[model samples]
Target chain A: MTAWRLIDSGILRAAEHFALNRALLEARRQGGPSTLRFLRFAPSALLGYHQSAEQELRLDACTELGIDIQRRISGGGAIFMDETQFGWELYLDRADLGTRDMSIIARRICEAAARAVSGFGIDARFRPRNDIEVGGRKISGTGGVFDGDALLYQGTLLVEFDVEKMLRILRVPAEKLSGKAIADARDRVASLAELLGFAPPLDEVKARLEQAFGAEFGVTFQPGTPSEGELELYRAALPEIDSPAWINLVGKPRSDLPILEAAKKFPGGLLRAALAFDRPGERIRQAWFTGDMFVNPRRTIADLEAALKNAAGADVAGIVRDFFSTRDCDMLTLTPDDFIMVVHQAMAQAGPERTRP
Target chain B: MTSIGDCLFPDELFYNVDTGIWARREADGTITVGMTSCACSMVGELVAYLPKKVGEHVERNKSLATVESGKWVGPVKAPVGGEIIAVNGAVAAKAAIINADPYGRGWVAKMKPANWDGEAAGLITGAGVRAAFEAKMKADGLSRC
Candidate 1:
């Protein structure tokens, strides 16, 4: 059986948490330990690795709410992390998994974690490139980083989520989420407390994850503290992570990206969407929609977003068409093309160049 | 030249195949580096790229740049320690260019090697780049391009 170390570090400042991420991954790459760590964030807003703080977040809201804004080593959209969510990170050599394919590896680990999450009496499954969901609502989101043979994959388990807080902390324009927008977000994400009517004990959730990983990888973990080397790196990386420049890396004006929203009355219902486009790349950076539409297998919209993530603007129609073409979802009277038409209507502000035939 | 799984791995450039990165020697004795085609296919369309600044010295096998796809961000390690001379400004402005042409306009950086002779000893070149990649793919249970 493989030996893995388990670390449970209580609530930590955003900088310290991220610093440990860098430190532990480095140590493991240098042959430190095959480990799993559990961490908690001190109410914070974390931006993806490549994203600039000014561009992706609402600094005023975050400051007013007392949410610490930071950056993560993994790539993905910005997220609001707090003690309500539990973070689990895995550090291991690539050889340990027997596959060098990044996507395949992500799927494998996510499936294992989903299995463990399901053990908590809620049905959960791996939703793709990186998310775990229950009934189409995301319960967990994951991402990773690799250096040489070592890899660090991490996920957040939403034990007790706060959708309103998340909406405030994220850069979603205030006017957009005034009333119905808040309800729309509630439809997208779910937490354990919401599912089971009470937050499961944090320790029990950790145990389930540990047991699931143990069975999947055929390993046993002895709960322990990080080694001296990891602590050393944590100490060294803290200053770099805590500074404003590090958080504000790659400052680009938001004017480069304008928020455009559109809607239309269709046979099925009203469909609305807010589009974020990268003019130069002509790709959709992010899209969120809220409307009265009937679709079965409710996860279809989120899955659509997953499929359309980073889609080339030039290929929006093709991407939307292909997405619906590949999936079997019942949207009642609305066709997948209708969803496309509504999103395009929102993108009209970008100009006719994006409205390709 | 060898094409595996439709990925072109020219045997002419020196490759650190495991990392899926390649380095080519320029006429001025500097080195040009870029990600392998396999890397592009695996990561999908790269939407964002941030390379280390020009003039900085990076160690062999360390990050020369970082790229993002599907919100997954990771680094492209340097194949040899050297002074970074220039970065691809075009790719910086439009990252899909790297996925479109990894070896040519997509090249990440130009470097003045600090130990070209010593580091070059470890990197494969000529037909060796293609063969090494072929062997790697075979061992990884991959199909030919």
Candidate 2:
């Protein structure tokens, strides 16, 4: 059996880390070995490949906090990455997964990653599309990129989290950065320290992941470093990845994505919906929920938000209906229609205005 | 028109069988490019399309545009490289239009080919289209579009 390779690229600047992302994925695309790599970034705000910096991040805040701003080779939402968290990625051929369906591939990889997180004695599970959550609160978020037959799937593990710090860096659609919002953010996201009562050692964390992935792929990992050829590619890619031009590849005006808000008090609690509406596309680019909601499992709101990102306006009701029907969740007395109605109220500016309930 | 399962391939348009994109040689000389129905099904629904600026020249098989769906983002390569002349504003406004109508209003970009007479040979069309896509679907482990 051919052995898989493993490499550790400890904390580096955002640009350097991304350059390695480019170099290694390129190597894998050109017939390099299937490998797993561990990485971390010194405080940075990274944008997904298709995102516009102006639309996703608060530039003034990122600049003031000495946070490096760059874009991922992969696509997803903008994220705040810092040394406090850890990252893991896998490079493999499609044959390894035995499927080419994008959503299925994502789900399978997340399931394995969830197993890795589960090894830490917390009940972590895969949430469809691309997230690993612990009881509805997200612990890891992932995305993928493919070049030829080689694909790279990567995700972040929140070892230590500061909701306020994240709120400062991101123009989150869910709610404005406020003391109450921070509390809600905590409800939706948590750190390894918060979940386990202490941060697990970095080596133990890596070993747990290695064991999970090794079992999933039915192969053992032999420690290795970037080949010289990969280093050369990394050097060449650094200049472009570190420049201003790369960051502006998908520039869009913030006005194009405006947050539309709606709130309602149900028997369960007051649930607020803040949708970052895409004006021209008539899509909800993202929806954030914040209010005195009393869902048994707090992660329901986060999962619902994930379900509705870039969702079509007309499909909101059906999507919510489908979501509730398929998922096992107890939102006190709140129903899916309550969620749909609030979203419709938020979309009033683009469509027929609904009277406040 | 020829179809493999639910994917439709018009006898008139040419395809880059490797990349799953189609190119149409417009009467006016510019080429219209878009994803095939099978390609659309593979990615589910498109949420965004960012095309290269009009007038920007691209090499053969290079990215003419970036498309995102299901949070998985990647490129739609040019079948025959040339300068982008126009892009579909409607599809940009609502990307699901591409899912709704892949061959018509969803045409991704219009390009002025650099050497259509030469590069056109690289694309498959006519009777060959069906076999090419059939092989592709099998290789991709896809049951249907």
Tell me the number of clashing residue pairs for each predicted model: 6, 2
DockQ of 2: 0.54
Residue pairs clashing, model 2: A136-A299, A174-A288
Against the native chain B, each candidate's TM-score is: 0.93, 0.95
The TM-score of candidate 1 is: 0.94
Query: Model 1 shows how many backbone clashes?
Result: 6
**Per-residue lDDT for A315 in model 1?**
76
lDDT tens digits by residue: candidate 1, B27-106: 99999999989888877778889999988999999999998766557789899999999998878767888999999999
Please tell me how candidate 2 rates in CAPRI terms: medium
Q: Give stretches of model 2 more than 4 Å off.
A: A327-333, A350-357, B140-145
lDDT of 2 by residue, A1-357 (tens): 569999999999888988988899889978888999999999999999888899999999999999899998887888999988999999998878877678888888899889999998999999877888897788998998776567889999999987898999988874467788888778778788899999999898899899999988899999999999999999999999999999888888887778889899989889889988887777887788878877756667888888898788888999999988988888889999999999998898654322211
lDDT for residue A353 in candidate 1, whole number 0-100? 49
Give fnat of each prediction, in order. Answer: 0.52, 0.59
